[model samples]
Target: MPRTAAPPRTADLQARPYKPGDKVVAVVDLPGVPEGTTGRIAVADGLTWRRYWVRFDNGEMLGHVDQHALVRARDWDAFRHARELERAEAERAAETSAEADTDAGGATAVAAGGATVNGVAVPAHLLARSKAARERLGA
Candidate 1:
């Protein structure tokens, strides 16, 4: 007698953009996570509303994440830009602190209320104003 081959898996009727082996990022926290995280698409299901099986960097596998809750991982250029802006803000805050110390005859002067960036205190109103300006400028 001849050996028989296994049957092929069933194909989904619905169409979707993503497929297995695609990289993805979580726009919102996955189940049991404290916050949102990124993952790889281990399985893609076009038939269901909950469409992806995501494998996170930490070795955890999420069985079902909706397509809307995830985006292509390559689309994080804006996030990278925001991180660069945050680093620049921290550096500026440190420089301002040093200048204030020098002007105050080496005495430490604590800001009453402000936004702290990278452990440096920046004036809250200034930070807020700058943020508004950036938003207006579409940066």
Candidate 2:
């Protein structure tokens, strides 16, 4: 059998000392963590005195988070990319309403649809359907 020597450790592979300007990953650990219940990991821009002031992937400015709950991010670049994708997906979903409206020549119209309004097919125009929807027997 042949023996191979172990590779030298690299600075990049080591956990960096916590720094105010350094990027970190926020982790939430429970008192009694159980299997399958994972803590949250988020990218933090920087740290404050005893906490971190960073923006979450959801764009909420989490002004302060416990320093003990944060760790040096394993891959900052990948984290940033994932966060961006998450934000973009959220924005897209928010802008694109699941409800459909009949837009005809820049104007909305009322029409029958698979959706039910007062047990009847909903109109294509969301607004019109809503207004007429109030006329339901028990609505």
TM-score of each: 0.40, 0.27
Clashes of 2: 2
lDDT of 1 by residue, 1-139 (tens): 9999642211211123578887776665766542346678898776656588888876678876777766667654444454456678789999998887565532322344554554455666777799999999999
Residue range 8-84, candidate 2, lDDT tens digits: 23223223435445555544432333211222333334433455454443344455556555545555445445546
Off by over 4 Å in 2: 1-64, 67-71, 98-109, 112-139
Off by over 4 Å in 1: 1-16, 34-36, 48-50, 78-139
For candidate 2, the lDDT comes to 0.46
User: Against the true structure, whose lDDT is highest?
Assistant: 1
Candidate 1 accuracy as lDDT: 0.64
Every model's Cα RMSD, please? Answer: 18.8, 15.3
How far residue 128's Cα lies from its native spot in candidate 1, in Å, is: 49
Q: Pick by TM-score: which candidate is best?
A: 1
